[model samples]
Target chain A: MPHERVIRHGRVEPDAWRFVGLDEGEDLQALPHGAIVVPLAVWKARRDALLARLEPLGVWLEPHDEPGEIAADLPRLALVAVRFPKFTDGRGYSTASLLRRRYRYAGELRAFGDIGRDQLFYLARVGFDSYRLPEHRDPEAALAAFGDFSLRYQGSVDDPVPLFRKRAAVEVRHG
Target chain B: MYRYDEHDRKIIAERVAQFRDQTRRFLAGELSEDEFRPLRLQNGLYIQRHAPMYRIAVPYGVLGSRQLRKLAAITRRYDRSYGHFTTRHNLQLNWPRLEDIPDILAELAEVEMHSVQTSGNDVRNITTDHFAGIAADEIADPRPYAEIVRQWASFHPEFAYLPRKFKIAVNASAEDRTVLKLHDIGLELRRNDAGELGFRVHAGGGMGRTPILAEVIRDFVPWRHVLTYCESILRVYNRYGRRDNIWKARIKILVKTLGVEEFRARVEEDWAELQDSQNVITDAEYARVAAHFAPPAYEPPSDDDQAFAYAVASDRAFARWVGRNVHAHKRPGYAAVTLSLKRAGTPPGDITADEMDLVADLADRYGFGEVRVTHEQNLVLPDVRERDLHDLWQRIRGARLATPTVGLVGDIISCPGGDLCSLANAKTLPIAEALLQRFEDLDYQHDVGELDLNISGCMNSCGHHHVGHIGILGVDKNGSEWYQVTIGGRQGREAALGHVIGPSFAAAQMPEVVEKLIATYLEHRVDAERFVDTVERIGIAPFKTRVYGAGKELARAA
Candidate 1:
C-alpha cells in the first residue's frame, strides 16, 4: 500500500496507525491488525473486549461527540483523533482544547479529514499534535503556514499566558 | 486614537502577507472558490454585484487625520473617486479590482489600519458611542475596554470560524448611540456604589431577518473578568450554534431556542472554568490602553466664550448649525461637531476623495488630530473649540457639509441597496434622493424636529430601519419593488423596534407616504413633542389613517 502522509509538528511523516470504523450494529470482533484507532462508540461499547485484545488501542470522535465522554478513558488510550466533516466545521478546535486543557489528556491528539494547510496553525494553537493533510496538498509546502504569524494576543493551549501578562512580566524584569 | 504597538503592527503585517498569498493561490486556481470565500471575507473583501467591495475597519469609530489622508489617497488611487461609510463605522470601497487589493491592504497597513474581521464569521470591529470619553453623561471611558476586546478578538484561533458573523458593541453613556441592543453581545459599562467598574452584559441580540433584543446574561461582570466572560459567551455560541441553516445560525436563535435562562446558565458554567484563567485582564494592561485615550491638551476650562457668543449673534446660519449640528462637550470651552454627510444630491454616507482630504485638513486645523465616524453615517470632530464655530461653519458651508439638519428629516440613514448590493431587494438611493428633495428646505426640516428616517433594502437591517423613528423597508412584490413603512421606532435610552403601519407602497409614492406621516405628526403633536413621542402618545392609528386614507393627496402633491 502507498504511504499515508501526516504532518506532525510541521514535519511530513508516514502515518503508523490505521483507523478502524464500524457501521451501525457491526461487531467489534473483526478489527484491523497493527496499531489501530477505533470509533468512540465502538470503544465505549466493547471497552473490556478491546482492552483484552492487545492492539495498542486508540479512539476517534465525530464532531458531535463530547470530549468529556472519553475523559476517564484518556489514561489508557494511546491517541485521540477528532474528525472534521468539513473544513469550516470548527467544533473540533474547541473539542481539542477541552481534551488538552480541561480533560488533561496527555496522549497524542490528532485531527483528520478535510483539513488543509490553512487550518494547521490554528489547530496547533488548540493543541492538536498531528494533522492529516488532503491528498492534493503538498505536505512540504504546507509547513510555511505554521510560521504565518509571529505574534498572537489571546491565550490558548499552546501558550496559556496571554501577551499582556507576558508584557507585564517583561516590565517587572526590566525594573 | 490608539496607536498600534509593534506587536499589533506585526500581526496586521503578517495577516496582509498571508492574505496576499491566499489571493495568489486562489488566482492560480489552486484553491476552490468555496475554500477561498471565508479567507477573503475575513480580510474584508467581498465579491459584490458589480465589482469587489473592500471594507476598511475603523476600530471603535476612531480615525487620525493622517489615516484619513491615507484613505483618501487610496480611494483616489485604487477605487472610484469615492467610498461609502457604512453604518458600522467602516469604509467600503465600492469599485476595486480584485488584483489591486493586496497593494491597497499594504498601503492601509502603513497607516495602522486593516480590514481584518470587518466581515465574515468572526468578531467584527468593536463599536462604541462616537461620543465616548467626551459625552457629558458618560459613566466611564469605554474606549479602553473596546480596545482590549479588539485585541483579544483579533485573529482569535478558536472562534474564527463561527456559525455566522458576530458583532459586539460597548457603551458607557446614558444614551445608547452604539445600538447596543442590536449587537450579538452588548457591554454597558457601569459603576457600583463602591465605585467599582463593571459591565451589564447582554447577549443574543441581533437585527437581521429576526430582530431580538439581547437579554441580560450577567448583570455585572467585573472589569478584570470581562475578557473571560466574553470568551464564555463566544464558546457556548461556537459549539452549539446551529450550522445547518444560514438563516437560523445567529446566537439569537440559539439563545431563543434554549431560552435566555438556559443560555445564561451555559455561559456561567463555561465562565466558571475561564474566570481564573490567564485571559483575565490586568490593571497594568488596562492602564496601558487607557493612556492612549486620555484627554488631549486643551486650554484652561472657562465658561465664558465671548467669541463664540459674538459669532452666534452675528450669523444666524452659524447659530442654526450650532443648534442642530454641535453636540455638548463635557469640557466647558469645547464642543463636538458633526459634519453632515447627508447632503441632498449625494448618497447618505458617500464621501468623495477630495472631501475626505478636506475633512482631514479640517480635523488637523479646527479640533484634535482625530475624527470619529458616527453609526448614523456622519463624521464628528470630537474636540472643537467653541470659539472656532463660525470659522468652521463658513469653511464647510461651501462644500455642502454644513447642513444644519443632523437629527432632522434630511438626515436619513440608508444602505447601498440594489444600486450596489447583490443582496438588496430594491434600489434605495433613488428613494433617499426623492425624500431629500422633498425636505430640502432647512427651515421646514428643523420645524419637523428630531427624527430618524432610515431605509433598508432587505430584512438585513444594515440601515437599522427597525429602530428608526420612521422606517422604510423595501420588499419585492411580484418581481417589482415596493416600500414598507414602520412607525414609532426609537433608539436611545429607551430602544424600541418600530411597528408596520399598513401595507407596502409603490416606490414612487414613498415621499408622499412619508409626507402624510409627518403631516399627521404635526397635526396631532402637542407643543415641542417629537414625532416618535406623538406616535407613542396617540399610537400609530392617525399616521396609518392619513397615509392609507390619502390616495387623492398623493396625486395633488405630485
Candidate 2:
C-alpha cells in the first residue's frame, strides 16, 4: 500500500503535475514551466507554441474530448490527465485505455475529478498512474484500495496480456 | 456447480476483505450515503422500508449442500430465520442489521459465494433454467458457459458501474424457461448446421416502467468467442447507453433509440477488435469448467419399475405431484423435482432456515447433493432418481415442499411488496394470500391448470409480471392499494409481454377479477389450451368484458 504516497505505475512517487481545468481560464504560459497541464482544447490550439518551450508539457482530457487527436502529440506531452465529470460516467476509463494501448502514450497518465477513491483500483488497472482524489477524500486511506485485488481477468492498458494467457503460459512453462 | 479454483477463491476472499473495509469506512462517518451508495449496492445491500435487505447472488442458482447449510446458518444468525429467493435466482435476507452484512458476506465467501454485483448497476447474477444441464431437449449444458460469463463479469474494471442494473440469462433448451427475451443480455446456446455449439445472442431486453424484448444481436457466435462477444456488447453499452435520465438509462432504451440494426453494427465493430483478445475460451479452459458439471453416476432401471408404478397408482396425492412437479431429465433414470416455495399463506419465495437445513439434508439423501434455485423462485433437486421419487416426495411432503402446484395457479411469483420494500407502491403479499384462500381447493387449482400468475409490487416487475399468463401489478391510487391485471403473456421460445385487460381494480376486487378471467377461460370452447393460449386465441375482449361487467369506463391499457 502506497500510504500517503502517489503512484506512478508500480512505483510510489511524489505528484509533480498540476491540474488546470477548462473553466479555470488561466494563461497556461504563466503556470510552473514543466508541471503545467492545460485543457485539451488549449493544447490542441497552441500545440506548436507550447512545444517550443524548454520544458515538458501536459494536456488534460475529459470523457467528451477527442482523445484521437492526442496520438500525434504523445511524444510532446509528458503527462495526460483524464477527467470524469461524474462518478457514474466511466467513459474516461476507456479513453485512458485507448491512450495507453492504441496511442501507445507511455507518459504519466492521471485521473481526476468525480473519480472517487473506490475507483482507484480499476483506474490503476486501466493504466492510470496518478489520481487527484476529490478534495474531501484522504489519500492515505485510499491507498489500501490499490492492493485490494491481486488478480485481474481481463487485459487493460497496464497489462496488455490478460490473466488467462499468462496462466496458460505458466502451465506450459512448469510442464 | 463450478468448483472454485485458486484464482476464484483468491478473488472472492479479497472482495470480502475489501467490503469489510468499505463497511468500516461507511460506518465511521468517512463515507457519505452519496459516496457509499454504489459501493454498498455492489455488495447487494439495500436500505429498504423497514430495514436493510441483503441479497446474495446464487450464481446460476446452483448450490452444493455445504453452501446451502452456510446460507441456512447465516439466515438463522443474522436475519428473520428465513430468506426470500428473488426472481433473478438470488437470495435476500430481509432483516439483517446494516453492520452484520460484512460478516454475512465473509461467511458467504467461505462457502465460495458472495453477493457481488447482485444488486448493482453492473451485470447481475447470470440466471438460467433450473433444469439447465439435465433438460432432455437441451443441446448442450449452458452452465459452463454461464460460469464463464459470471467470472468474466465479476469486478469488471470498465463496467463495474453502468447506466443501470443489468441482468443476463442463459438457456440451452429450445424452451426459454429463464425468460430469455426479458433480460439485458440473453444467451441461448444452440448448435449450428455443422453441429458446432454456438450462441444466439440477444441484447437490450428489460422490464421496468418500459418493457422491451431483446433483439437478436448475433444469430450465431461460437462458444469460443462468448466472452469477447459479451465484452463488446457491454463496452458499447457503457459507451453509448443513456446516462442523463435514470428512468431511460437501461440498454432497452438505448436499443430503442439507436435502432437494433445500428446497435448491432456498433457491437460488431467492437467485437472485431475483441476477437484477438485473450478473452476467448479455448477447449482446455472449457473442458476444465465442463468437468465440474459432468453428469453424476446413475443406475438404470428395468423396463418398468413396479415399485414406482405401484406408488404412483396407489397414492392419488403422489400421482398428482409427480404429474406437476417432476420434469423428465436427459438421463432417463434421473428426474428433476421442483420443490414448491410457493406455499399458500406466505410470501412466494420465503424459505425458513429450518426448511433450508431440511432441504440440504434432503439433497444429500435423495438428490446427488445438488440443489438449484429456479428463476421462478423455487428449489430443485436436478438429479433425482425416478426409483427414489416416492421416498423423496415423502421427505419433501414432510417439509411442506411437495405442493403439487409447480406450474399451477397457486404457484404465484411475487415481490416483497409494500410489506417490506420501500419502492413498492402497494402490498402484494396479502393479495397473494387472499387469492390462495379463494383457490385453496387442491383439485380445483389442479383443474385450473398451467397458469403463470405473477404479481409485482409496482411496475418495476421484480416478480416478472410482464411474462406471466395472468399478470398483476400493484398500483397506488389515492393511498389505496389497487392492482392492474394483464393477460396473454408467455415466457418460452415465443415470449410476449402481457397486455393490461382494462382499468385497475381495488385490492379487494383482484381475486374476483382473476376468478372472472379464469371463468371466462373455462367457459370458452377450447380443448386443452392453457390459460395463456386461450387468452391469446380469443383475445382479451371476453375476459375484459366479464371483469368490468357493464362498466363503459373501461379501456384497454396495453
Candidate 3:
C-alpha cells in the first residue's frame, strides 16, 4: 500500500508492526525483527516466556478482554492494539481511551481487525495512534478524517484540558 | 435558555462539516449502508417508512424564542412546514431528503444546535426537569450541571459507541418531574449535612421490554465530581455491557444481571482510576455554565388583579384552564403555563410551523423569551406573570393551543409509533385522536380527574408507558395491532411501573377498555382519589375483573 498507514497528531506514517492474530497462532520463536502483536490469551498464557524474549512485544485485546482486565501487565507492553471484532461493535473505543487515560499504557495504541476509514477519525480522537485498516479502504482519506474537527469540548488522551477549562484560561488572559 | 459560547459554537459548526463529509461519503458509495447507519443515527437522522426523519435535540428541553423561530423556518424550508416534539424533548422532522440532512444540520449549527446523539447506541441528549429554575419546590436548578455534562459527553471519544442507547436524567426538585427512575443514570440534587449541594445517584433504571426502577448506586456525590462520576458509570457499561444479545444490551440489563451491588462495585473500580483525572468539574466551570441559567428577573408580589379574577370568575372555560394548565412558580407574582399539545384529533406533540412561530411570539410577549418542552409532551411558558396570564390565556386559547387538560385524560403521552417509526408495532396517532375525541368534554375530563394515559407503539417505551398512571403498549399479534393495558403506574418522587390489566384488546375495544377502567376508578373513589390513587388503594384486580371479566388471573407483574 502506497498511502500513509497511521495518523498521529494529524500526520500519517507508513505501517511497521506485524499483527499475529489468535487465529493465525504465529510461532513466537521464529518471529520477524519488527514489533510483534499477539492476542490477549496468548500474552496471558505465555507472559513469562514472552517477557524473556529480546524482540518488542504487545497484546491485541478483543472486545471482551478490554483494557480494564490487563491493567497489571500494561507496564511492559510496548504496542497495545485493540481489535474491533466488528467495526459496529465499538467496545474497543472505550478500551483504547481507558488504556491511554486510565491504565496509562504509554505505548503505540493501535486499532486492528475490521477497521474502516470512517471509524478511524473517532478512533484517533479517542487515542488510537495507529491503524490496521481493512484491505479495501483508502488510508489517505482515513488520515484526512483526523483533522475533521479543530475544536472539541471534552478532555481526552490528546487534549487534557476540556473546552470549558480552555475557555476559562482564555478569559483570564484576555480580561 | 443557555446561550452557546464561542467554543460551543465552533464545535457545532465543525460537527456539521464532519457529518457533511460522512454523508458525502455515504452518497458516493465510499461507505456501505451498514456503516452509515450509526453515523446518521448519532446525528439524529433516521430512515423512516417513506422518508428520512431528522430529530433535532432540544437539550434539557430549554430553548430561546429565537431558536424556536429558527426551527419553524427550518421546518418550513426543508420539511412539510411542521415538527413534532418527541417524548424525550426532541424536535422531529418527518419528511426530508437524505441528501438535505447535512444542509439542515448546517442551518441548525448557526443557532448553536445540532442533533448529536438523539439516537444511536451512545449517550443520548441528557434530560432534566422542564421547570428547572422556575419551580417553587426545587432546591437548585439542575440545568447548569446538565449543561456541564452535555458538553463533556458531546463528542466523547470512549463513550461514542456503546452496547445500546444510554439515557441520563437529572432532577433538582424534591418531587421528580423528569422521571429520574426511568433513566439509565438518575441524579437528584440535594444538600448534605454541611449544606453543600450534591447529587444522589441512581443507576440502571430504564423503560423497555423489561421495565425496572433504578436502585440507588451512591448516597451522594459532591457537585465537583459529577462528570467524573458519570464517566465512571459509562466506562463500566461500555467495557462490560453485553454485546451478544441486543435484547440485553441496555445498562439496565447489565445492572440487573450483575445486581446493583456488583454494578456499583464495578463503577467504583472505574472511579478509583479516575481519582486525579482532569475530567473533575471545577467550581469555575460549573459557575460558567450556571451563569447561562441564572434566574429570570422576577417582579414583586402583587394582589390578584380584578381583571384576572373577573375573567376566571365569569367564564368557566377560562377558570378550568387556569385551574389545570397553570403551575405555581418561585416568584410570587409569576406563573408557569403548560400549553397542551394533545388537542383532540391531533398527534400528541405535532406543532405546525405557524404554531411554532406563534408560540415563540407568545413566549417573548408573556414569558422571558423562552419556552420549555416537558416529558409529558407539552410546551411550557415558564416566566409568565400571573397578572398577565388572563390575556395570555385568551391569546393562547385563540390560537387553539389551550386544552384545559394538563394531567387529565386528554393529555396523553404518545410516540409517533407506526406512523413514522419503523420499529413500532402499531400506529399510535389514531389511538390518541380517538381518546381525545371521546373525552372532548372538559367537565367530563375534569370530573374524571388526574389520569396519565401513556402509550407506546412498541416496548421501547418512547412513550414511557411503563410509568404512566394507565399504560397502553402496542403489541403485534400475528400481523394485527393489539393494545395491552396496564393500570396504577405513577412517575414522581414515588415512581412505579403499571401492572398489566389482562389479555390484550383489539383496536376497537381500547376506548371501551379505558372507559371501563376509569368507570371502575370513579365508582371506588373517596372524594378526590385519582385513578392512580384508587388503583393503588385497592389493586389491579377490580379494574382487571371489570375489563377482562371476573375470575381472570393477572397475566404480568406490575
Candidate 4:
C-alpha cells in the first residue's frame, strides 16, 4: 500500500482509515478489515448493518449534502469527512461550520479532495482538524500554511472572539 | 484616516508574506494557472492585455498624505509613471510585473494599506460617500460603521470563496453619493424616532451583464446588529447563489429569482439565530473605531478673505472653477475642493506620479493631511480652508490639475477599454477624446451646465454607464466597434436607469450623435434645466427624431 499522509492538528500523520464505496458501483459488503468510511447514502441505507461490524466507522459527505442529515448519527461515528470536489466550491465551508457549530459534532473532522496548501489555514479556522493533501503535493511543506497568518480579525470556529472585542478587553484590563 | 493598530499591522504583514509564497509556487510550476488565478486575483493582481495590473484599496475613499506619497513612489518604481483611479475609488497600476507584486504589497503594508479583497470572488473594499464626515446633510458619520464592516469581512473564512464577486457600499448623506442602490449590499445610516442610529439596508443590486436596482429588504437594523445582519445576507447568498453559470452567478439574479419578499424571509431567519452570537459589535468596539473618525480640529470661522472675493470677481476662470468644483462643508470656515482629473486630452481618471506627489503636498499644505477619492474619479482635499482658495488654485494650476469642468460635458468618466482591458469590446479613450475635442472650449462646456457623461467599453459597467445622465456603451457588431447612447439615467436621490435612444453608431459618428443630442437639449430647455431633466420631460422622442432624422446631414458633417 502506498503511504497516505494526513495533516492533523498541524502535523503530518498516517491516515489509518480507508474510504469505501466512493464510486457509484463499489461494493458495500466484504469491506476491508480495518477502519472504514462510508458514503452518506450508504450509511443511511445500511446503518444498523454497518454499526454491527464494530470496527471504527465514519461517514463522508458531498458538497451539496446537508450536514443535518448526519446530525443524529454524530455520536456513532469516529470521523466525518467533507469532500471539497473543487477548492473554489465553497459550500463545504458552511457545511463544516454548521456541523461543528450547530450540530456540536466533536469527533475528528477531515477535509479531502482538491485540498491545497493555500486552503489549509482557512480550513483549520473553520473547524477541520485533519486534511488529506492531494497525492502529488507535499504534506510536510503544506504544514507551514497553517502558520501563514499570525492574526485574524473575525471570529471563526478556532477563536470565537473578534479582534476588536479582544482589544477592548485589553483596554479595560490595563485601565 | 483610520490608523492601524497592532492587530491590523500584523494581519497585513502576514498577508504579504502569504502572497509572496503563492507567487513563488506559481513561478516554480507547482501551481497550475487555473489554481493560481483566483489566488492572485484575491490579492488584486490581474493579467491584463499588456501586463499584470495591481489595484490598491483606498479604504472608504480616504487617503492620508503619507499614504498618497507612498503610492506615488510605488508607481514610480514598479509601474509606468502613472496610475488610474477607478470609479470604485481604488487605484490601479496598469503595468506592474507579476514577480514585483509581493514587494508592492509589502510596501503598501508599511502605510497601512493592502490589495486584499480588492478584486476577487470575496468581499471587495468597502466604499462609502466621499464626503462621509464633512457632508452637511448627513445624519451621522458612516466611516466608523464602514470600518467595522471592513474588519468583519476581511479574510472571512466562510465567505472567502463565494460564487461570484460581492461589493458592499455604505452611505449617510441625503444625496446617496456612493450609488447605494447599485451595489450588492447598500447600507444607509438613519436615526429612528428614539434618536438611536441604525441602517436601512438594501440587498442584491449590481451592474454587469444584467442591471437591476436593489430593493430595501429591512427598514431598520440596529447599530449593534449590523455585522450579524450582513452575515445573514452573505450566508444566504453563498449557499444558494447559482454556481452553474458564471454569467448568472451574481446575487442580483438570485434575489430576482426568489422574489424580494422570500429572500427577506430567509435572511431574517438567519439573522434571528446569529443576532445573539459573539459576532455582535460591542459598544466599546464601536467607540474605538468611531473615535478615529471624529471631527478634526479647525479654527473658528473668521471674516471672508478679501483676496478670494477679488479673485472670484476679476477672473472668470477662477470663478467658474469655484462654482463647479467646490462643495459646501458642514463646518463654516472650511470647504471641500475637487481637484479635477478630467483634463481635455487625458483619459478620465489617469494621474501621474508627479501629479500624485503634488496632490499630497497640496493636501498637507492647504487642508488636513488627508485626501479623498471620489466615485466620480476625482480627488478631494476634504478640509481645505476657504481663506486659502486663491493660493491653492494658483498652485493647482501649475500642475494642470485645475480643469474647471466638474460636472460639465467635458468631464467624461470612462473605463480602460480595448487599449488595456482584455474584456473590452471597443476602445473608450478615442471616443472620450473626440468628445473632449468637440467641447474643448471651456465656455461651451460651462454653458452646457452640469451634464454627466459616462462611457463603458462593455456591459460590465465599470464606468457606470447605467447611472450617467448621458451614458455611452461600446458594442461590437461583426468585427468592428460601435457605440450605443442612452439618456436620462441619474444617480442621487431618485436613481434610475437610462433609456437607449435607438440603434448604435460607428466610432467616428459618436461625437456628432452626442452633439445632436446636446443641441436638442439646448433648444428645448426652459430656464437652466439639466440634460437629464429635459430628457425626462420631453422624453426620447424628440432627441431620437433629431439624431436619426438628420442622418444625411450628420454623414455630411462627419
- Candidate 4 scores an fnat of 0.72
The ten-residue window of minimal lDDT in model 1 chain B covers: B549-558
Where model 3 places Cα greater than 4 Å from the true spot, the runs are A1-11, A22-34, A66-75, B551-558
| Models sorted by lDDT, best on top | 1, 4, 3, 2
- Residue pairs with backbone overlap in model 1: none
Q: Model 2 TM-score?
A: 0.95
- Candidate 1, superposed: residue stretches over 4 Å from native: A1-3, A22-29, B302-304, B550-558
What tens digits encode model 3's per-residue C-alpha lDDT throughout A10-102?
A: 555666667665555557555445667778877877788778876788888888875666789887888888887788788888888788877
lDDT, model 1, position B154 = 92
Instruction: Provide chain B TM-scores across all predictions.
Output: 0.98, 0.98, 0.98, 0.98
Task: Name the runs in model 4 displaced over 4 angstroms.
Answer: A1-3, A24-34, B550-558
Over the stretch B1-558, how does candidate 4's per-residue lDDT look in tens digits? 689998899999999999998999999998999889989999998999999878999989999999999999999999988999999879998999999999999999999999999988999999999998999999999999999999999999988899999999999988899989999999989988888889999998888878889999998999899998998899888888998898899899999999999999989987887767788999999889999998889889878557777888998888988998888999987889999998867899999999999999999998889999988999999998887887899889878788889889887899988888888998999999999898989888888898889999998898899889889999888878888889998888688899988888888888888998999999999898999999999999999889888455444321
lDDT of candidate 3 over B120-199, digit per residue (tens) = 99999999999999888999999999888888888887787799999999999988899899899999999999999999
| lDDT, residue B467, candidate 2 | 90
Evaluated against the true structure, the overall lDDT of model 4 is 0.89
- Top TM-score model: 1
Residue pairs in candidate 4 whose N, alpha carbon or C atoms collide under 3 angstroms:
none
How far is B435's C-alpha from truth in model 4 (Å)?
1.1
Residues A1-175 of candidate 4 have per-residue lDDT tens digits of 2248899878899889799876677777767777888889889998998999899999999888888999998999999999988899888888888888879999999999998999989999889999897888899999898899878788878887888888988998999
